[model samples]
Target: MRYLYSLLLLCSIVLWSSCRNDFETEPSTGNLQFSRDTVYLDTVFSNIGSSTYNLKVYNRSDDDITIPTIQLAGGESSNYRLNVDGLPGKSFENIDILAKDSIFVFIETTANIENFSNENQFLLTDAIEFDTGANQQKVELVTLIQDAVFLYPEKFDDGTTESLSFGFDEEGNEILIEGFFLDETELTFTNEKPYVIYGYAAVPGNRTLNIEAGARVHFHEASGIIVAQDGSLHVNGMLSNDQETLENEVIFESDRLEPDFSEIPGQWGAIWLTAGSTNNLINYATIKNATVGILTESNDGTSNPTLTINNSKIYNSSNAGLLARTGHVKGNNLVIGSAGQSSLSLSLGGQYNFTNCTFANYWTGSYRSLPTVLVQNYLETPEQIFVSDLIEANFNNCIIYGNENRELVLNERSEADFNARFENCLIRYNDFGFGSQGYDFDDETLFPGTIINVIPNFYNPQENEFMIDEESGANNLANPSTATNQDILGTPRGSSPDSGAYESIIFPEED
Candidate 1:
């Protein structure tokens, strides 16, 4: 009798479960609230995909409401895409929102450049339609797309990407690099539309790639410009009248034009000047979002500096802003900030001369082990430590300060001459309980009139603002003989100039 009762109870439970309506919802009223009336996506390159944006749909009434339809107004043939709640589609049906609750809708897009015709910017529009008939409601979608000069390596029939012939590995194996050489006829980058490069663009061995003033160059992930053996690169940028309109400054940065990525570090690879590349010069340029801003690899034989850069800013680098491994580099009125590692690294033995420059590394990324400025004359390998003579590492009228206790590090080896000097500079350095390897503040020859362990009082180093405040330790202390007459922004530095890349001034409204 007990077994018979159990069986009857199981059958009753199954019948009740099957009769329940899990998806029951009430019809929404004509009033539907949205987080925004119009969703404006950030500007994007024609063929590039945009970042995902979201919208909130609120059911303010005290009832579980069902939206009959949520869709793009362009129907099935729109450049935009939508994801209602959790499901992705051009249109959705029967989306339910609980009482006093909200559901999210995600939107993204990729438009074609041809549809834009000759217009500098094309406005693409669409709408998300909810319900139908008298209960219809909509939220508009808009985006401004720009035409770009896209250059990428060819894809093969086998679905493999193209690779350039890099020299060889230590074992004589051919090293193929994922890149392409620009056509000889199109070596010059003009001030037309922005250039979007997909991979490393190699300059031909004997050719030069000239980037004109106001030319904007964008590099995709892991992409950059590489100068081949004996090749040269010249960035001819002029100073702009308005500081805000850095219009004439040649800008090199990541392809993501969105404001959120402006100070994000390590978006692309370095502007690599290969071993034999020579006479690379850059002026009035702004290079940002690189693993290493400029990597000059061992152009040691030439008396002339491998790179001569002036009035330039290098920011948000993962590694060193200006890294010269056994090479020569000359810089003036340069500002480098927020590098994960050293902001100015003259490492593995190099010849460097920097005047009126700022190396302020307020790195917010992972913990940094190195200082803001590091001058090392040795490279340690697993097998052994190799020491090279650091011919000269001179910093005149400069500022090397950061969040670290020690912003300047000098690493030397007994076998090599690690010659370095600092003159009339404001350097942030504290003598640790454990001694600084080769630090001597009393030596006038090595450190002439240098201010130690003092705040340069940068406007805001964390935000990549290197301009010094009026009450800064760097004011009126520069060695004028070695300093640049003009600041990075083309502001004239008086005879008694402030140190670092910028001259302290009474700012606009502050005056």
Candidate 2:
């Protein structure tokens, strides 16, 4: 008897739920409200997918409302894609919203910039139509697309992606890397449109890749530019007059344009200069958000400088801003903001020189264990360690500081010729490693006018602004003999110039 009674009660509950599920909704009135009348998606590259954006539809009436028809104005042929509520479709029918409740509509787009009229940026327009007849309503959708020259490896008929030959592996088998060599005609990048590169843009041997001023270069994940053996990379960037807008400066960064990725690091690989790639120059440029901002291997067995970068900025690298391995590099008025390992890493005994440069690493993304400037005369491998000649690692009127206690680290192999000198520079070192490395603070021969553990008094290192304050310890610390005449901003560095990339400037007080 008890079992029968329980079964009857369960049946009654099931019937009630079935009836509740069959509840009806009234047709939506013309007076429906929306969270926003228009949804503007962020800009995207031509043929690239845009970030997902959402819109809300409100049903404010007492009764549950049913939208008779919800579809895009361009219909099935529209570039925009819609996902109404939880159902994905080009057009949806009988979309119901509970009383005083809302439903979300997600939008995404993949469009060709050529399809849209190019007025400044290629503007794409579409509308989400709700209901029909006199009760029709619309929620506008817009997207801005920029035309870009996309460079990627050609796909074969198979599902596998094409790859380039990168020599052989230990097993005597050929190793293929994901990249393609740029042809002679495609070597030069003009300022007409931005370049979107997938995989590595490998410059062939003895070839030269020129990037014009005002040109923007974006790389996809694990992608970068590789100057082959005996190749040259000439980035011809010009200094802009307005400090706010570095209009003529060339920018090399990740392809992601979303706000979340603006400050994130390690989005792409490095601008790699392979062994024997000589005569590389980058001026008035910004290179950011890479595994390594600039990776230099062994230089051409010559006295010529491998790379000469001036008036440039490199920041947000996961590894190192300047990673040189047995290479020779020179820089003037250069600024490296932050990195996971070292802002300026000279490993395997490299010849590096920096004049009036700022290497500040305030990396908070991870618990950083390395210093801002790490100089090593030896390279560790699985089999054995290799020690080479450093010759010179010089810094003049530069600032090497970071969140770490010792921003300057020297891990040397005594057998190698590790000669380093700092002249009129500010370095943050509170540890005793310098003493153990056979160095003296009072040694005028190696450390002349070099301030130790003194605060740069940066306006804000967290925001990558190294502009010093009036009471900065770095102010007037630079030796007049070694200081550059002009800062990175083309600002005149008077005879008594301050240290770092920028000379101390008086900013107007905020009202």
Candidate 3:
């Protein structure tokens, strides 16, 4: 058949010349071996975008090279941004790299700082380079940026978009909200720089906001801080008098400055306070991760306490670290910790008063079905059935522990009014199930001088560290004049007081 078609065209030309001699055009004499000549990319926040940073590039010699130029020394007017191996670049060519193989690059940044004018942080640099065959390499990158106070949400022209306004709707009608109201000169927030929000920032009814004291805010992703109704939000974080320094506190988190997002729980939203917002304070401050760290709502029976936390610390909340629907809150040296549901939820009920607080919840990030203080009153939807009136839910010298086994929960609801109280507290709850509709740590008149299922040696409930171990059983049980004679780091508290917000201070074991 014509000599088998010339032996199938000479075996397809010897398999395309043995696949072009198994690739390897040589041409690189640079000896490239980087995995980090200078990546840094840390602080970010002027125009935001960051967090990719990689590098690799090894090819430890065995031939196959070719890199003639990979560069971005500010190439396309760079503000940093590259990709390289998967191409998306500021410049690249030849590339290839086989024999001892390795090649990644990544890097990212956003930085705009309105042409940066020398102030609240601003470094940003760049380099990359590489060119081969005649040698030339480099890497460096750096970052820093900062310059915040962003806030967002405002897009009128009929396309509608202002944000932050859940105002009226319990039959008082008038509801049509959706944010945007600040004005009182943007409401305060000072401590020199970092703010960043990006959506719900409301506060308008009678306006208040404040913030100051080393402020740092952040937010983003589902942002927060509402307030409205009669509005007010204070925050003042103050301590410095040898309290070993939380500098000046005030740090609401999550704009993700990445360390794998620190303790990453809900990453933002909540700090609401709504229902006719009243006094609202929040001293020393810390409020972390979010999605409910201070919700509030319900108050209208005002007696001057609609919120008044002090020496604050709400931690990684994925739901409630102090929610209080029928609100009236009033903490003191508080501490709240990890919570995928309740670390103090007092739902649909009002008037709560913690003191030397510390509600701990060893939530290892997932599967935490409630409890760490819940006390409810009523809430059945399907179109109406609300009920509220928890009239007074106290908890002096508190320490309600958690890691479940019933860490306190009382959902009452036979037509409202659940009135609570648990003095000299330390309850880790073992459900002493009392009649008339639940709750009874052996009812010593509703848990007076309460201690129940004890074990508050804390000092590190898996690191949320609710400081207390001096062979704690909440040592000296508290009530030295209703606790708080210092603690929350200001130390003192001695004539027999140590219960929760820290006051065990011994130190001295460091051979």
Candidate 4:
């Protein structure tokens, strides 16, 4: 009887608890709180899905509440999608929340910008609406969708990759490479849209890849543009009268649009110029965040320069900023900084001429062992060895400085002719323990009008600003004949120009 009474009492308690109306189902009191009033999905390419963003809907009242309707303003035809609780839909009804409890709403979008006629990008907006009786709560969603020409590696149905035929190896063997050649229709890039490259965009022999002003090119990881043998590349970026804006500058960077990745290094591969590629020119361009900014292979003994860079900047490279392997290069008003290795590397013998250029590497990412500038004449291998003559390497009105005491290094083999000169330039080198292995700046014939061991006083090294301040020792140090008439910003240099790529401009102080 005692066991039967206990079972009957337990049954009665269970029935009462099941039938109880403890949960409040009344309409909300028109008081709803949200974690954020707006959600920004950042920037994404057209027809590409964005990352998911979250919004929290909180109930601060003491009693439970139910939302009558929660829906997107655009209904079913909206580009944005949402997930409420564990259900994915555009609308929800009668969502219950306990006292002081919160629920998360996940939102994402893949905007179709085919109808957008803007030159650069379009703004996509939407709103999430919540209705509880006569009151309503809303959260605005915004995103910037950019239209771009997407380039990726081609994969065939048979699981094979597209391949191109380069010329040949030293033994006359055919060289097959892993890349696709661009057609004639895709050789030119205009300013109407940005380009997003996934694989190496190779320009075939006898073809030219031209990029107009204000054209932005974004590269994915380990992807870049490669000029094949007998090909050319022309980048015609110009600077407008407004020096503060990036309006007319052609930018080559990573595809990541996040702000945090703007300064990160090694985001992409190099702009590679293969052997026999000639007549390549890059003017008024900005290249950054790459493994190597510009790389040129061995020249084909042509008098034409392998690359001619003018009024350009290359920064934040994991390897050398400008790497030349037995190639010929000429640069004017060029600035390169923050390289993990040397800022300028002329290896395996090369002919280089730099005027009014700055090679500054203050890399703080790791302990750097090499100097800012490295010049070598020969490369050794176990099976064979090759040597070439460094015809001429002249630095005129240039600034070569870094955090280390010595910013220039020359490794010469006895068999090659190592000819280099520094004229009217500022260099950072202290000949304390560095013996005769280094070049002597005291020799006027080799180093004419060269200044040694002087502080450059750059405006800001941490921010990668290599411009000289007013109090810099390099002010008025360049000879007028050796310097370029115009600076990197298109500013005219006076009679006595300052060293480096930029001519110092004094700004008036405001009261």
Best by TM-score: 1
- Report how far residue 279 has shifted in candidate 1, in Å: 0.9
Candidate 1 C-alpha lDDT tens digits along 1-511: 9999999999999999999986677998877799999999889999899999999999998888898888888999999998888899999888899889999999999999687678767999899899988999989999989988888888999998888887798899989878899887669999898999988899988899999999999999989999988899999999988678789999999999888888899999989999989999999999999999998888737899989999999999998898888988999998988898999888688788999999999998899999999889988888788788899999999999999898898888888888999999999888766855647777899999898877787777788988877889999989877778888877788788888999997654545
The Cα error of candidate 2 at residue 72, in Å, is: 1.4
TM-score of each: 0.95, 0.93, 0.36, 0.84
- lDDT by residue (167-282, candidate 4, tens digit) is 79889997765567789999999888889987788998899999999899999887899998899999999986665667898999999876668899999999999999999999
Ranked by TM-score from best down, the candidates are 1, 2, 4, 3
lDDT of each: 0.89, 0.90, 0.82, 0.88
**Pairs clashing in candidate 4?**
none
Candidate 2 local lDDT, residue 407: 86
All candidates in order of lDDT, best leading: 2, 1, 4, 3
State the displacement of the C-alpha of residue 46, model 1, in Å, after optimal TM-score superposition. Answer: 1.1
Off by over 4 Å in 2: 1-17, 30-35, 60-62, 118-120, 133-135, 158-160, 432-439, 508-511
Name the 10 consecutive residues with the lowest summed lDDT in model 4: 430-439
lDDT of 2 by residue, 308-345 (tens): 99999999998889999998999999999999899988
In candidate 4, which residue ranges exceed 4 Å CA deviation?
Answer: 1-35, 51-71, 82-106, 115-120, 130-135, 165-178, 380-386, 430-439, 507-511
lDDT assessment of candidate 2: 0.90
lDDT comparison, 1 vs 4, better candidate: 1
Question: How many clashes would you count in candidate 3?
Answer: 6
Q: Judged by lDDT against the true structure, how good is candidate 1?
A: 0.89
